[model samples]
Target: MATRTSALKLLRSSLQNESADFRENQWEAIDLIVNKKKKLLVVERTGWGKSSVYFISTKILRSQGSGPTVIISPLLALMRNQIESAERLGVRAETINTSNMDDWDQIKQAVIDDQVDALLISPERLANEKFVSTFLEQIADRIGLFVVDEAHCISDWGHDFRTDYRRIINILKMMPNGMPILGTTATANDRVVDDIVGQLGEVEVIRGPLTRESISLQNIVMSDQSQRLAWLVENIPNIPGSGIIYTLTKRDARLVSKYLNENGIHVAPYFAGAEDDESTSDEHREKLESMLLGNGIKALVSTSALGMGYDKPDLGFVIHYQAPGSIIAYYQQVGRAGRNIDDAYCVLLSGKEDGDIHDYFRKSAFPSVHEVELILGELENSDGLSVPSLVENINLSKGQIEKVLKYLSVEDPSPIYKERTKYLRTAVDYQLDTEKINWLMQQKTVEWKEVKDYIWYGGCLMNYLQEVLNDEIIEPCGKCTNCLGEAIFPVEVNHRNILNASAFLKYSEFYVQPRKQINKGALKEYSIPSKIPANLQSEGTWVLSKWGDAGWGHLVAEDKHNGVFRNELVKAMENMIIHKIDPSDFPAWVTCVPSKRHPELVPDFAQRLADSLRLPFYPCVKKIKDTNPQKEQQNSYFQCVNLDGAFTIEGEIPDGPVLLLDDAIDSGWTFTIIAALLRLEGSGPVHAVALTSTAVN
Candidate 1:
């Protein structure tokens, strides 16, 4: 019953523009989904109106008495944008995500009563037993259409593959035959496309050229973080309009945002906040997105969490603080710029630390053979184990345990099944796919190499991106640095700006938050309570730098290897503590976290620091037993267990607050145990300080 004219009318209504029409193949996609009830894959570039196809299709299908469409979206931001877009065309759309748990029952009832036209849910919801039973199963038979936004994630070969997306294929297998299904993305390469097609079975493919004529691409190399920060302070103000600045890590996102703000630029740092952290809640991210869209901020310094399905048509620029790990990811991120504008800029700033960060991500992406075997063995022995129980027993972090379980439970003839809150092993013997994992690692290496090549490519940066993505049509854009034979932004940074940036990095300090609770059964001999007693805990710790990072981090690293802290390092620490710490919180005396491996290293530094602070020094804490380095213990339980009975308080107790100093801090368990010991011996409030933090922020 849907025709091209009716689709166009609906599109115009959605866009609020009477003259707007479908781009090439848009109508064909709608026809396949609505008229023929066929599964379709649309691989078009950004701004090609992919959402219009599904919105219009949902309208046609609902009018014909089909069930409401269910779209498995990836992000809350994406869902909000889609719901708004759907509303413009008179399509009633609602979402059920983590942020709105209380509304699930009402939304489900609305779907059952045929009051809702479309439903958007995250991919993780498909794996939730309660959601599947209470909502999805109730309306499975009459469901009109199923949509997968960011479909490339369904394939492990994709640049941003997520384990939760594999659940979509299982849902697809259970769908009734001839039901309309749609998979859409703008960044899938040929290999990722093939993998997705194989997963979806036979489906109509609509592919298009992946070129953005509106964006001018360039690559600039900076040797260090300070230079990059200086460049941003100088150049971002001169850019055409508000946009996004991408960082590879959350720490850099915050660091860049802080530096830019200090220099009078309006910006905010955005990343996937820790679970239950209200500052980075769904509402907060939505607010930031709205601010960017409204041009209230200059740009958002963000991680890849802001990458997919974020809709903003007139964004003017996207500057990368470091090169992304792959060209596919680069294209997807940069594509966010110039969606509806005539001119925008896409710049990549290469750094020395890019390769190291990429390597860390690549190596940790998959569970190792040993790790998988250990988890399966434990599950095989027990009746069942919850995630927390597994974390307490296994040496793996909670994240690693969850990843392994999710991967195993999604297998055909799955080796495990979840009952209530625990995962139980099945009779099926699971075999590790070493070959496939190795191949994937090799693929990642190749992708990273391609990114490096892109930085130095001679022909055209946009052309290189298109070719890497296997775009149907690739040609020189005549708009990149290679095409223009020069850079668009000034390569040289102001000397004063660099000095200011370096000083800012040097003075930045991060607090080492004390652990409030001990893992159950971790210190059975010590009889420590689950909730650490507040009175016995250290006030907190201040880390002067991140290990081997900007500012004093490199000096800390160098000093540690040379077996002595430099005088300049001590002076810097003294200056930082004086300026950064509250006067009332200053310690009355100083002590060192005793180290058996290098006993003199920390003690010598502590003694000098005590002299500089004009406070009495005490060799109060003694290492009673040698233990494994805290870094070797991957999880909290193991880290706590390793330090049990490892230290004891020696010498006379101090009456006033004490400064506990260490060369480097990781896990913060050493300081916690030491502080508790000092507190038990009648020492005053313990203030902890460290030269640097070894853990990645």
Candidate 2:
């Protein structure tokens, strides 16, 4: 066994942690790495010093004249933390990632010369042709240790598994016999543990109790979005320290951050949603992380993007505005709180719309079999179309198209292959198996149920999570809301603030940004036989509410039943038209987007709207085909194609402006195509209106 004295010295000097001793399992894990030279899997809760095991071992091994350690990390944020930690230990460390493109050659040289003791890389880096062919191959003998952080992702059973992580399996097979491998994770159940162990061969398995003594877990069953917002505005200040508030979607994150900021809480939303701008840059994200570490802000409202790699020891509290989809996800996110402090609040506020939001997420995990077949058929028929070209032909979103191509192209037995940016079908006879897909669907359903189980399960919330993660919970935590019999309602209710939140939810003002680019074949398919003119577009298309918002979203979904509304739709439409959208130059005539499935529903609403506004109603556009639902088309460009020939002029229309109405605006493709038709015949301006905007949905 290695001497404990040297390990302790290195650990103290590395972490600057005042704890003179190591945790019970920390020393054993390090010994196996430095002494036994055996693979290991450490499954402990977060903040349990998993990084220290490898860091200490890297120092010991390097002291013994061994080679550098290579860590396969999942995120850039995680890489930054590891690099800084290694440097703190006096270990020469460097990272190769997208941001440091300029220094990659020099970093490569440093690795080749053995000047760097540790190197951090992402899983996606394994698939980069230049990286795999160059530095990775050259440093094969120089890598004494291979570490897979967030290793739960390597197992398909884990909730957050990335398909790219499969590369670790092949890398594992290529490792030399004596080199020690370590797989570490904070959330791994029995199935995930077994799957990870199976991938790494015979290895030491270290498990620990999943409960945290510092976190006081709690949950409140909120009635609606307004109540939750009001509660957050009133309650966040009471929480002990500055921490994170997790949201289910980017829209919610930004909205909540705005509301909190308005109510005097200094919080900024952190998410990776840029319509076309550069992605969340490393410098910006790092600065945010630093601010949070130093308590410069009250909190950061974020999605799961900020979950794994960040380390703020004394985070005050963590509150989830909506319940997570699974227990595993909840545990991993809530683990971020109370890492260093003795007590921190972990709260979850359940919203009625969470189910709707999660449904949107669940359906998109992998493309449907029908959708995949459509993409493959399109690619096979064309001569290796690039992604942008596929965007013109296929009906999938840019994100979905790229993901489908990436998964198929990266994994073995791929039926479709990419060559020089264009894709083509290979001789590999592969199709998505029905049974496997069905099983995956079944698994997802069970996971959703488990999330509900945690809420309604009476005994102990922490122990419930423990059992879910396959940990032994011998006794109740006695710290959660249920165990303590402590129910926290609105400590101080503000009737005015509550009403203000309700007003904000009801204040529905959303935009319909027109699609600037159309598929090459779409205009011809519609028989317009001309490019869409700039004037032939809905300039001020408006919607009353957004999908899953607090205000008209709930009323439209439940009251209108996502169908046609009577007085509510008329009143909301008039309110929007008279106040929100009054084009002085033209208020000509009114029309509605004809629906094949609900033909009478929309025209009835439109005719009523025309009478209310004292304008003539025209059935100007017709559904050309028994057209597919816009939702089914998955991609915006294809959505336009689906509606291309579906609309034609009712007859020779007047030369005045036209007001088009629809139940919901999905892709804005329908608006663009119909506007082209309206302008083609003899209509002035076309302003589209809808009850809600389901674009994000």
Candidate 3:
């Protein structure tokens, strides 16, 4: 019932442009879905109008008495964009995601009553038992079309594979035969395409060239974080329009945003915020996105959390603080720019820490054979265990445990299942796939090498990326720095800017928030209540730097190894405390967190600090019982259990507020336990400070 002419008219209506028409294969894909009810995979570059095909097809299908189209989107940001786009074509669209749980029942009822034309949900929702049974199953038979946005994620070999996406194959297996299914992505290559095809089965593959003529690519190598910050401060203002600055970690994102803001650039740090904080709340992320789209801010210094399917057509540039691990990922991110404008800049500033960060991600990507065996053996012997319970018994972190469980449960014959709150073992015999994992690991190594090659590659930068992605068109664009035989932006950074950046990094302080509650059963010998008493709780602690980070942190790490704090570090700490802390609220005395391995390590530093502050020094907190290092303890329960009854106050308690100093803070349980002891011994308000903290704020 759907024709090319009708599709064109719908597309024009959606675009608000009467002269607009479908690109080369958009109509063919839409017609195949609407007329023949066939499965299709579209491998096109970004801004290629993939969403238009699905929206137009949904409109045609609903008019012909088909059920509402269902989309399994990968991100909340993508869903928000798609819902708005769908409304323009006169399609009634709604999304069910983590942000809008309260509206699920009403949305489900609307779907049942044929009041909604399209439904978009995250792939994680397919794994939720309540959502599947109560909502998905109710309308399963009536679904007209199935769509998977960011389809490359379904491939384990893809650059950004997610465990939740494996559930889509199971959903496909249950769908009625001849139901139209569409998978769309901008970054899939030959291998990823083949894998997605194998999973989806007999799909029409529509592939296109991956070259972007509107973007000019360049790469610069800066080994130091301060140098990169200086480059951003020097060059970001000269870039034509608002853009995004990508950092590899949340800590770096915050650091870069802070440095840029101090230098008069209006930017905000955007990353996945802590679960307990409102920083990355749905409302906050949406607001930031809106600001970037409206050109209210110069850029968003973000982690990979801001990557993929964020629709801002006129985005002027994308600058990476460090190189990404793979060319495919880099292509996908850089593709976000120059969609609706010409001459958008794509720059990659390589750093020394990029390889180390990539190595950390590659190694932690999969559980080892030993870890899988330990988890399965534990699950096999017990009736069932929750994630927290498993954390207490095993040495794995909560995230690693969840990864293992999700990986095992997605197989054809799964070895595990969840009932209510606990995971139960199935009869299926589980064997670790070392060969597949090894191949995947090897593949990552290859990908990382390719990224390195791209950085130093002598050819046209755009051509190199296109060739890596197996794009059919491999000609130079005559726009890249290499192609033009000149640098687009100045590579030399000002020495003064670097000095300012270094100074800022040295003085940036983080707060070590006090733990308000103790894990149950972690302190059986002590009378510590589950809810820590407020009067006995330590005030927020000031952390001088992050362990092994830039500026003072690097000095702290070196001093810890050398077993003596440097005079410069001592002077820096004195300056920080004097300027950061109110004179009236300054600690009356200083005490070190005693260490047995290096008995003189912290106490000597605390004594010198006390001398500088003209306060009495005390080596009062003694490690009465030897305990495992806090870093070895993976979870809160294990961390708390390791420190229980481990420390005791040895000397006279200070009358006024006390400064609890340590070389480094990891779990903060050490400070908590010691602070409670001091408070109980008649010490006034306790203030905790550390030279460096291991945790990111």
Candidate 4:
């Protein structure tokens, strides 16, 4: 323990000496690395200094002890960058890959002799039989720390996946003893984290913030096609520094780069799968490298493959030529600009074309667990398969194939390190439920409710559902394209246009309209007695009663009728009120179904029922010229009903017990509306009850 502590202190000292570190973002991660002994999962966004945490952690581990530290990275370029950094800083770090195979014997000797403190290898290299055996025989028990960079690649759901990463768990077990692992990544959703937990078996998680505060994010909606091009030309030169322009396709990368070049911006373009010259050896590679490192090239517009090792910190901005398939991919591409964080900007030039791109990718992005299982089973039955073979035979998207490999590695660790041809157990046992997978897969494939074909529009689609359908579960997504004024397509084109064409409009309006004489008189024939529901026994309350289709009658009842709509009118009456509201106001709200239902009746039938029951109605008393000593003006009273739409009681009401009525309560909107109107008309705190509420839809 003393020796370990001392070594850690030395490591910390070395790191502090090496870099001019910023205290804020760097410290939180370093503290976690230095103090936390358990396995740590750093879930952060891109360009958030995920790598720096490990660098410091490695320094501490190497300084404190006689143990070896192995950093397993999926990207060779990333490994090379780390190695170069360590060399420049005069720290101990070395990488092993195909290029370094000639020195394999010397490297093996170094590890065996305990001369090297830190070694980096690809997951593919560690999974090699000879390498695993060598590590187990010599360096396994001595390893104090293990680093899995780009750890999300071990999950089937991560943005950038490599099938080989899944085998890492088995490699860990092959070590002499289990030690704490540090897994890191810039892109990991919840699903990816679950996969990582499964692989490490005994694990601890420490996630950083997903929102990058230093990076400015902007989304521009373009209607005209040429606007995007014009913006690109104007913005690129003004920024004046190293930057990346990301595009959806290789063709776009080529076109955009050419356009920029034609407009006097020096630019270079590279596509992921584009062919290279056959004759290009080391010199040819150097020539291509020069263009990237060349002074003339101001900006490089390309696909994701271009910037793996090209970490230029002075990048002014990152502009999206088109929308990437997923948010994770977008985050990853934009993250390239703000390395070391001196403040940078990322802009998305999104439009209708981008939506098409997103839809295409989302639809084609999913892979089947069955296909993944088959590929792995075949490899176990034979030897491990190459990426190309899996891609061809599985018939899955590249992203999907990567994800499957990631899942298998974490879920079934034993298979990762197996070298002999072994009959495989079913990989399906560890896969996600097929039904859920299908649902999520479908979500990614389609554009979510294109507003043009949608039912409601003023706010977001969610608000529309809440108002029109009375969906209690739906919520307002405050940052929707509608709310942000960031849409390429016209919103008016897709609105349901319900106000003009809807049948419920007129009825909803009439329910809320002020009536001068709801009841005829207090005379013998006008007063009515109705039994109220037990749930609403409160006096002075108003409720709407449904007599039949389009026959909603307002009843101001002192007590409840059984236990139903004690407040507002039914959907039928609510529709009438909505029709009265000017079409200009797009009201956004959510509501739950009311507790009551009632049958509708004709006006004559309603009047007859009231007369038979001796219900009292007070007529509007206008101000009289000749004042009778006993007669007083009765114009201060008002009654109201909750309709679906907005309406004001425009006239004076006769004071006294003002009874409000409309329709049965289907949703609470009726009650709220009635209560508000009653209050406005000097009806004092309203106490009302309702009749039956029948389901309309």
C-alpha positional error of residue 236 in candidate 4 after TM-score superposition, expressed in Å: 1.4
lDDT of 1 by residue, 336-403 (tens): 99999999999999999999999999999988888889888999999999999998888888888999
Task: Choose 1 or 3, whichever is better by lDDT.
Answer: 1
- How do the residues 437-475 of candidate 3 rate in per-residue lDDT, one tens digit apiece? 999999999999999999999988888888888887657
- lDDT of model 3 at position 604: 91
lDDT of 4 by residue, 1-697 (tens): 2233443344445445533443344555555555655577876655555555666566666666637678887654467556765654345776777656788788877876777766888777754666677564467777867888888777756666665776676777766544657888766766678878986876767665554434555556554334565677666776646677887766557656766776688886765444356632333333333554443467777777654444455566788866665555665676676665556666667645665555655555544656556656656565566554444444443455555554454554234433353223344435445785676666444324432223224565334422322223344444434555674223221123222222221122212222222212211221221222222222332223332322243232322344333223344333332443333431121111122223222222233323433444322211212221111211111111112123334456545433334324443333444444445555433333334333221
| Poorly placed runs, candidate 2 (over 4 Å) | 17-19, 100-106, 113-115, 274-287, 371-385, 388-398, 409-417, 424-437, 488-498, 525-541, 547-550, 557-564, 574-626, 645-660, 675-688
After the best TM-score superposition of candidate 2, give how far the Cα of residue 26 lies from its true spot, in angstroms: 1.8
Top model number, lDDT: 1
Stretch of 10 with least lDDT, candidate 4: 633-642
The C-alpha RMSD of each candidate to the native structure, in angstroms, is: 1.4, 3.8, 1.5, 26.7
**Candidate 2 lDDT by residue in tens digits, 1-697:** 4687889988888878668688878988998899999899999999998888888899899988889999998887788888888888888888888778899889889888889899988788886656776668777766889999999998877889887888777766666779999999999999899989887889889898888888888877775778888989988988777999999888788788888998899988887542224444666777777778899999989888888868889998999999888899899999999998998888888878888778877787776777678788887788888988888776677898887876776556778865667889887866777676677767777888998878777788899899889998888888888888876444345788789888777764666676556666665566544455677666657888886467877677775555667576687778778876656845688888888777788898889989998999989788777778888886666676677667777776766778888878887888877877788786888888888887772
lDDT of 3 at 537: 91
- Root-mean-square deviation of Cα positions for candidate 3 versus the true structure, in angstroms: 1.5
Determine which window of 10 residues in candidate 1 has minimal summed lDDT.
273-282
Badly placed stretches (over 4 Å) of model 3 are 274-280
Q: Give the poorly placed runs of model 1, Cα more than 4 Å off.
A: 274-280
Name the 10 consecutive residues with the lowest summed lDDT in model 3: 272-281
TM-score of each: 0.98, 0.87, 0.98, 0.53
